[model samples]
Target: MRIIRTPASIYLFSISVIGLLFFTFLIKIPQHSDWIVMFALSGSILLLNYYTILIPPKGNSLSMDSSIYLASIFLFGLHSTLLVLLIYSVIFAIIQRKIAWWKHLFNFSVYSLMIICSYYAFILIDGFTGPISVKNIIPYLLSICTYFSLNLLLVGVYFVLEATENIINFFKEILKETTATYISTLVLSLVLVILMKPNHLFGLSLFTVIAFLLSLAFKQHFNLFKEISEKANKDFLTGLNNHGYFKEILEKEVTAAKENEQPLCVVIMDIDDFKKYNDLYGHIQGDHLLQEFGSLLKASSDAANYIVARYGGEEFSIIMPNTDRKTAYSFMNELRKKVNDTYYKGVEGLPYGCLSFSSGIAECEKETYSVSELLNKADQAMYAAKNQGKNLVQLYNGHSEYSVQRSLSLEKELEEAEFQLKIFLSKDVYTYRHSKRVYQYAVDFSRMLNLSVDERKTLILGALVHDIGKIEIPRDILNKKGSLDPHEWEFMKKHVTYGKDIISTNKKLEDLIPLVELHHERYDGNGYPYGLAGKSIPKLARILCVIDSFDAMTTERPYQKTKTFQEAIAELRHCSGKQFDPQFIEPFIAMIKEFETSGDEQHKEVAASIVN
Candidate 1:
């Protein structure tokens, strides 16, 4: 007979043979001395076995029965442990009618192996066979661990075959996740042993009551933890990922894609003329639009491959891993059509006449772009779609030449912005040079992030003009060699608003207002002015904040001592999520290192061109 061949079949056959031996062992050494005690323990355990707590989504289970089984091993030794385990397995199999006969046999054998190994492990360590004591603690601990290890091995082998994943990784994950529960089980088992020592029948009955009560408590606690975790990861408004969670996933996906040399696509989309819709219908209706739209995206995408998130306000983003730009664009085109067909209450009144969105797509191409750059390129494409009268899809690619016209148009205006920045002369030598350094940082960051020509133009202008508001601050406050007083610091916080006002006066620089106005806003909503937080801060503004702050720290600021490059980087890492948008931190650090490696001459040239 081909009883043992394939891994599963071999396990099945081996367990069946082992179970046959255990049954013979139980038959030979019947526990005639404690018939009443065994019967009561078995009956109580049989009832307890029917109820179990399920870990959601995966539907894996935990049971309090392990404690009783362990206690039985100490009370009645190997023979009773096997007998109780066999009876428990049979009743459990009967309740779970869908479980195959062979699986039942396997589970029985698994229990037999674990209990026998534990029984021997206890004896080998000189543990007492009955009525445990604190002196036997070492033996008891080793016995329990032996049982746990054998149980893990038996189940892990099957998991390895079924999951087709790395065995070590699976073991590590399993061990980490279940350590708490297992340790709790061990403690409970020891308690059961103590209880059973005092009149086994009465002790077992009381322990059974306690076990069921504890199981119900654990179930409630697990559910509560699951709910809180879900809330933490989700956006309160639309039920998509919050900004913090979205970046976390994006970083993970990007790293995996780069390591595997797989394609990762980013789509940054904006609902066309959403502000008009909001103004016409009010903020309540505007929120309804966001909710309705987010629901549609979440439902349409397969969550395993694509993650759709509300990218703050009217913008939404989809991160699609293992997908190229073409596939992603095609997918977005279909999604766009779906949205266009679905009428919303406020969409009909807008310029587009119906609800529509503009989307841009970009793919990861090794050294060509980083995670932020992939998203930026996608953002650029979305803007390109918006510029093409909105409600369309565009791919970030080489064929685009609208970039040329934008750069040419912004050249003269950029020169003027630099001339205006000369006003920083009266503040301090550091203030005059800081904008130059920030501007250089922005240029390299823009390239690394794959900003479109228009985006790069706007960012460069914003970086050059971000501190133009400081031009109006008193020379004493600007050049102060010490920290500003409370009143003076409060005044310093108005630079973003001031910069926005100054830039808005010139129509050519009007698009730069967000960058000027929101740079000081922190990721955690603690920064000044409006205190806008997370993705609510415009992407460019967030990018400029990182570059601008790095320059402020590393350069000779009047109020703070300068830092070395390494010290400054450590500070950035320390405050990534709280102080700056974490998405840009890695890219900014990489750009600085590259700039250093290329020699200081190139850095000098980039910074000098901003004001020279």
Candidate 2:
């Protein structure tokens, strides 16, 4: 009903119904002699439809009714074919009354259109109702192709109008999924035409029986495939999803969350003092305890649509989509309390007595780079919970002691990031110098903002390596004397992704991924790779963009005319809110002005170095 309610869909459906009636009565009608054969063919279609083959692996159904219809068209001509369709549609509608009445009528119309067009095609190509012959091969192919194409167009358009599928992808998926099945149908129809030419009723019966048998065989194979696939993805002891399958689900959910701009949380939990329990109760009892715990986790989270997985050893993980860290912490804390109160055999010997676990929650943020990074954060949080006694729930805090330690290692990490940055010196001296200038600006701007020590360190390190992705660009494009062509410009834009990939290789530098990948993002949502807008862009990335762009505008390049510092500063001011964030522009401009007015020896030294 919803599908037919749309104007385009209603028009298509109405035209199809009108076309079917016009062709059935005016253009063609079954002769008195055609009644018996029509009934027989209709019966065969209903029987074949009931016993459709269940294809293996994906369990897609393959109906042999199309082959029967094609064979009827080839053997009995247009009038008998239409009569048979009329009988089959009426009988199918009666047997399938649970389906909506409009759906049944729409299906009948679509089939009628396919049969009418295909019959015309067969006749136009000099096809006749007779025994198979080599001379009629072209007609057979053309008519069957017409039937298939019209089926796709009519049905696919209805789905597209109803908002059920994307048109291009719908066609592509249908062609890929149905090609082999349709080919088999074409061959089977030809065989049926050959058999029915000599003895119509007997040939239909034999083909129907064989198809039914094959359907049964394929159904068994499909069942086996599903059985094996289930076992493969399930853990043996706990019966939850295994480590590999959990990762797959996490990756898919993370990607979906990022695209939909929804929150996702991952919680890593470990059974507290499990080794001590195993030492007191032996491995067999430990196995039982794990099974009980796994069942408890499944019971607790399944109602909320959380995916629970065994993360190996005594650790378990839960993927909670559309949940923030605070909600995740609350859910996990309640579970932790429930677990602590629940009694298990041999638990009295463990550290806290009764069953207990520690959990850590990490919410996927706008700047969270990868699933691995998310998991690492949760794993760290879980460990932090464990360090603060056994039964506890902790949320990941970016400014926690771990972050302080990371900041303390800024000098060492900066040295490593610079070593990577130096690769650009050989590739593009302009980019190398540009990165260094941005780094200096970041240092001054960070201090001016009075940011936290960790913030200062991260901002400085991020600016230093923000353009490290440029190393992947071809030197010719990197140093092109003229403006890059559109394709070259698009290719150059991939540096951010390349930089993210490069930084992700080293886990310690993963914190800088947002800045490296998002520095090109604009405040107004017009930039790539993701067009993140306004405050949604990370603050460090926003600052880095200001520095990166100002340096790019002022610094010398072979490709375009350069602007002076004063001109670049004016341009920055003019583009505020549209390109640069308004809050940071004046402070940055002031920093540059202070350096210029000071007539600093450092500037002269840097100028001398560049000239040399």
Candidate 3:
């Protein structure tokens, strides 16, 4: 219904007008005796529609009204069928007056069109109208098929117009779900025709009663199944999704987030000093506390469609789709304050003298390989919050963990990176020189952009190893001296992945993986790897792309011609938004012009300093 407005309104209006015209032309005045039968059939259709049988799981329904209409068409012919339709439509419109008047008119038109088409199809196929016989089976099948196809076409067109994405998948799902149900309903109509051949009123009465009973039986089964499913998926104590079910949903959401390139976050929280409260009170009182805590979490998270689950004793988790880590931290921090203010029984005996919790958030990133890894990051952050005296929210930071282990100074880290870069010297000397020049440009550019001390270090280090993946490429391709073939060009692109894998061997350098893998991505979403566009790529990676491409354009490569500094700057201007980020490219060009204006000797001195 939300899909019907403007163009859809006009579409429905046109179809309804055509249907009314068809109904007016096809409808005939029934004989005085046949009027009684038409009214009876119309009443039967109304009753059947009112008591539609809802299938379990998805809540789709089976309405027997179509069977009644098909039986009427076969028994009483076209005029009687239209008369039944008219009576049913008028009464139904009056009963369901709460629905929009236009929608009612549209529905009437759709049914009218279906009846008209099916009647013509039956007649054209030489269907016999008075009795049920084996000879007319082909006509009966054709007419029912026509009715089914017309319904699918009309409804499908409207929905397709409403939501254009995945149009082919939509029709396939509709056909798969509805084909069996529709076939059974149509076959039932034939059974009715056979029964009514002897006596109209008695056969109609028996069919209605059987259908009503079947609807009641199916309703009971659907209810039972729903209740059992809820029990299986929910935690008995907290009334939230159980650990297994939560993991199941998180895995699926993780896959969807990766495929659609959307942000997803997970928060793991633990109640601070919960064991103290449990020791003071019995385990039964602790159980009650857990229940209350789960209820609070569920109520707070319901508005965001977040999946909240009891991860274990005193620990709870929430999976937030399309949310980043910063937003997740803010929300959880607010919840922490709220929990502190809202007191629970015996919380006075606790450390903070009220309810309190520690939470940590981790956002999905390009480097996040699996759900377990993401959960581990959140767990680490949660422990970090606990170590910070509890009752706080922390966002996962990779550097925080590495600082505790290695804690290498910047100069030492630079030496480690330079050692890795030296491998390119023997394998591909051109690449080694290019990387060094790019590294130098990055140092100057980072200072010009007013980057932080840490950011400046990361940018310079990442620039040095960004092309480390090229180590895996064949020497013939790297120093080809001419254009590469299509296959060879594809093999050259694997260098980014190789670099990422190479750096991943050392946990301290995990922060540089995005720069190594994503520096080749374009600003307009045309680059290789993930094709991430605009700000979705990391800020450092975007800055590095401008520097990398600029150096590649100005420097001499075996297979490419070199451009002067002036020509390179002009090329950067032309491809600002396409190949490089406009925000960083303009500043980088300014820095190059500064070097050009200062003196050639100053630029050589900076290069010599980098070599030292």
Candidate 4:
């Protein structure tokens, strides 16, 4: 036999076993008096079951079958309740042939279990045997409590196992919808059970009519609740989730990412010159444009399983899960190009000459583990995109450095940095590798320190050639794996001055000279060449000191033992006030923490086991 032993199947089998065990307790079949009462109650349950109002993608539906079960139990006990529901469910299953066989079995078993648990609870609580009396309130309360508790537990377990979701959070989410329904079911059950004890036929008939009316009321109430929820979550104009709901989902996604060690990306977008387009077209057409863009975003996002929302007027966000930053950048930019090419009448009249937008992207693994931090980075990237030019997609690269207004010229400058590092490779291969490592560390740390776009550009480029002057020293001395003598050490110390002089020759690259010269300066004023100390050290240079030493500790060197990332961070913390600037330690720690868990190719094998 082909056996399916998945979580769903196992759960169904377990519950079915319990239900079958409950059936064994149905030995005491009721007499004529029970049948007379059960006949009307059975009909009521069957009719109510057929008229259930369903919730989407689930079996959470509104039905008055609980009152029938309660009334039957109060009248003739567990055996009668089981007998009534068994016949009704079988017919219900056959009538609704669309339901799978296992589902039908599961449904029947759930009801059987509920009745079993509730009946025993009622009896155990000293419930009266004969008539429904005020003194039997304890049993009624306990029974109602057991029924809902069992229902929640059985379904909750199935969902938790089937979906692999958090147990506590799943309960909280379901409670929002199911809490009131359970309360109403218990109250209605109590009323019907009491009335039926006096006259079975009349009470059952009255309850049936009352249940039909209640169903109508519940259907209307549920409809209204859903409508209200829609309005609250969605924007009035664009129909996208509003900013409030966006934050809600962002927080949830952050939690999920942290729990699963998965990556999440946030794409923040703003329509370029939208106000001008709106001004030229008027608010009526402007609203239409917003609607059109929202529709475009919704359609584009829906198929990708992204949560697209209107962050505010003219601004929007797309939250993507299990996506890397590189993939997210491509996706957002492709959409940006599509929007630019797609024509809106008045959009062409704006400066960009189309429906263009600026977008910023940030991923969870990029020093932005929290929702607020991710939003801030993504938002900054979006504005950086605007500053560079509209119709651009910018990934938050620690600092806003990549948003170079003069990117064509910036490209030329990058070639120079690469050229300097390349030339040094011939003289000392280790300096080449060391510079590269320092540059990469600065990239992550620059973002953590929130350096401005210009400063980040300078730091990244400077770190690349900070050791270029070491090329002038003898190759034998550079490659020596022992401590440097006095003459060799003095000669090596002159590299900073040599690098500064080399960088000063090019006006475009001159901003990096301070970083090249002052990176070795100490807070306590005992650094090389010049005894520059404290605030006297350039800010960029001070920032570079922490990162440079971090890279040195991480990578193998001729003199010092290469330290783990943790050891290096400790070294930085221990020397904070004396050697390194105290202000940069914490942010550097944050950046290193990001690198430890990051999936970035650079993070996999740092010269630096890392920190606590």
Assess the local accuracy of residue 404 in candidate 2 as a C-alpha lDDT between 0 and 100.
58
Worst 10 residues of 1 by lDDT: 398-407
Q: In model 1, which regions exceed 4 Å deviation?
A: 1-27, 33-36, 39-62, 252-264, 302-305, 321-324, 364-374, 398-612
Count of clashing residue pairs in every prediction? 1, 0, 1, 6
What TM-score would every model get versus the actual structure? 0.63, 0.79, 0.69, 0.63
lDDT of 4 by residue, 486-531 (tens): 9999988989988878877886776677788878989899997688
User: What ranges in model 4 sit over 4 Å off?
Assistant: 24-28, 33-36, 50-62, 172-180, 346-353, 365-370, 402-612
Candidate 3: deviation at residue 236, Å? Answer: 5.5
Provide the clash count, candidate 1: 1
Tens digits of per-residue lDDT for model 2 on 325-392? 77888899889888888889988887676899988888987666678878987887787787777688
lDDT tens per residue, model 1, 461-482? 8888888888777778887889
Model 2: per-residue Cα lDDT at residue 589: 93
Top-lDDT structure, candidate number: 2
Query: What overall lDDT goes with each candidate model?
Result: 0.78, 0.85, 0.85, 0.80
Q: What 10-residue stretch in candidate 2 is worst by lDDT?
A: 602-611
**Considering TM-score, which of the candidate structures 2 and 3 is the better prediction for this target?**
2
